[model samples]
Target: MTTLPDHYEIVRERNGYGSADGAVGPVPAAERRRFVAVDDEGVFDRADRRRTLVATGVGMTGPPHLGTVGQFLTAVALQEAGLDVQFVLADLEPYHGGAPLDRVRRLAERYRTFALDLGFDPDRGRLRTQEGAREVMHTAQLLAPYYDPDRWTEDAGDDSGDTDPPPTEWERAVREAYEAGEDDRRSGTAAVARPGPSSEAADIHSAVLHGADFLHPLYAGDYERLVLQFGVDEHHLVGMARRFRDAAAVEGGVAGLYTRMIPGFDGTPKMAKSIPGAGVSLATSADEIRERIAGDPGGDPARSPVFQAMCLASRYDAERLGRLERACEAGDETWDRARSEYAEFVVGLAERWRATEE
Candidate 1:
């Protein structure tokens, strides 16, 4: 909510943005393009001359939750719109994110299965696992020399305007990772669980590496068009595409599609695994999903996780969604009834995902 981008107006209506904000208008007929670091380019329309790739990824540090599924659903919408979509399993960063080795390994393996369950098209889009494809690490290594520690601090603070946060111990470790040749990485022994100051520090290095990992491969391979879909807050990583000197638009300059962060089920800031009762697991029972949704104290219509669920789930059923919206506007018992419908919508999605897995 800090600021809206130009593309936000166009893509927001595709129903993938998943905000409770009333629809401004249906997506207008326009030339297919995306927001680059400092420019917008007509890239998607020129697929005949060169291949187009739309990619989004998540760190495998936790189970796929409602938030995770929401991101995947948005990716699916992009694919449906004829964007070449790819799902990246960012399994590498958790290793440096201060997560335990066993936990990181487990989550990395588990995330792929759940991602498959979430209905990512295996035929159309490939799961670019960082573990399997060392391109993530290899790319990071190639781009590491470009960033000195000072600019590193600046690039890391892109999300926070004006105020640059203090450095944490994890940042020192990330710096060491940069200095230490690829063969000499001592990250495994030094890594610790991300919490408090450690999480903040771990994030800076993770962002640098993740960005390079994403773009370098495409750049090296000479991809004609690359669309990067990531968490809205992580746009700085996408901006790394511009860091390369003298690279023309034809060398696959990256465009960004940042997915909106889904709020927690209990209306806490963001849906996170570390926060208790804040996340609804993809495999949670319908009863459990209802219970979690009901736990939200409905003070603000906008903040209500139920309403957010409706925003996302409505993609599957527009008629029911319209009815729920009308009920909420009317107020009283009808509004209360809409809650159950929202719950039903979420449960139905979970059910479909489960059924498909079975």
Candidate 2:
């Protein structure tokens, strides 16, 4: 069995929250959230013994994108801090609704290779696909019923009619299959739900709300099961997990995943995937990275996607980062060079950081 670090207690206490009761009032949000903190000041004193950490998210299909890069950088920092980190590729999620099976598989392979090339240790960590995980489908099924629009009504005075309508008998059957632990049924249900994009924000909202409500409760049960199987204490992790699970349930879907929505390059409320020049992908070639920075609609590379990518990448030198910002503002001759320099710098820094542990 893996022994947890002494610092796990402190980190857990700092990040803990209470579990949710599905029918009751909503769960309260906690002040401090769980995260692996690492900087020049060094890793948290208690983090020395943390052997494994997991970073799981949906794979990129539109373009290999910078969001994936951000996640990998996060994993890299954890590994540099001496903790084992696993990158779980949630390919099943995209396969369910966003991307075709072949596209999803292709992206997963590319992402795995990118991660390996960038420094993730193949021995200590892996890029796993959720397609093989029966639990994900099972969980997806159990949560499907809560997504019924009839289960919730929109708040009075709210103009956005984003809440899902009542579930059809078909939807209920899908949920039943999931609840009964029918993996094949759950997968089939997910496969059927996978096509087409919703026309409005409200439609998207409704779908997310249902998914969150269903998944949160199901996750809580899974958490308890894991605690028992691993013989780990449920005190610290349970509360936060429950809070997120409940909030996701209440809000209805993955939309609640972002407690605070980040602004896009143009200072818009929503980031546009259609604007390729406005975003950066993890698989973005060096030339593409530079071109995007130069074409930023904001004209200020400091607040551009390039800068945002650097911040998320967390590999650029702090002093250099500031200089890059100032150079952009001043319209200095080195501004163009700064973009290339920063990208190369981050790539090298990530490589070095990943290599130290091995």
Candidate 3:
């Protein structure tokens, strides 16, 4: 584990991260809203004050990318704000997604390394793999009885990646097979709607299991507050905190931290390694970072991934962040210097990670 600062206090690019922007103070007109919008900010704020456990729950299906670190950055904020952090590695999930078992296993094994390189504090909270979590599996079984197939699939949503095709009833197929495989299956009590024809039955099943895994800690009566950091698209997962409120009553409060996914270098909807030139090369240098920044069509910082990356790299460097954000909004030349400095930070990160491997 690397040494972490007492607090990652940075001049936020936006006012409230996931709360009311003006609730605390005044700022830029555009700074009012957060990159990730939450419908129930009031309740979430109440939970935020309690001892919190910040967690990232996602399958290890892809290589490390710029957007992946964004969640870590959010974790750093929550941790610095005094929340414990947990990295939920859904290692068993790729089995359902049709990804290679060996590849996913390797990714899962190296996830801790990735988190450390990204500056996660291990002593505060450690990474837990889903496949090995018996309690989580038990909790998933308990949760399964609560979710009929229709409701489960409806909430499951496709969660399709950029390269993935349309939804096509993927949830239905997976749930049915999962229920069938269950030795204690109940008929006519599962899903009402039939899923679209797709062979990927395990994907939805794994998601259900994975979601249950994350919710388990909250209901287990340990942590006082649990904050989950997922992408904007996965904000619906936040609703789980609501559902678990009754169960959480004896346990703790739960909050959701959702961040905007940075766009690709060419400004795709979200950055991914599969996005041709839009991908973040693990071997990128300071020069490559400059090119990406220079080509950026800076309009709203919310939509600009380059600018967002600078914000994440800055971490606790609030003054530098404020200057960058102010310069960016006004299209000032200071943004150039900001970009150069940010580029160094990005390059330094990759070098640190690379050196760790050596």
Query: TM-score winner among the candidates?
Result: 3
lDDT of 1 by residue, 161-253 (tens): 234444333234333433442223344432212332246556656655655655754757745657677655455555455543122222555
lDDT of 2: 0.40
lDDT of each: 0.54, 0.40, 0.54
Mark the regions of model 3 whose C-alpha exceeds 4 Å error after superposition. Answer: 1-51, 153-201, 240-253, 273-276, 281-290, 297-300, 330-332, 355-358
Per-model TM-score, in order, reads 0.67, 0.50, 0.68
Please, what are the lDDT tens digits per residue for candidate 2 over residues 212-261? 32243245432111110000121222222333356445321111111111
Give per-residue CA lDDT, model 3, range 1-358, as digits (tens): 1101100111012112333333312222233223344333543345334445566855565555566666666555555545567877777766565666776676676765777667677777757787767887887777665544443343543222123322223223333344442422234443222222234557556756765766777767666666666765465465554453443333555555555555556535445543445546445665775677677655566556667766543463556556666777766677667666666666766675555445
Indicate the residue-level lDDT of 256 in model 2.
10
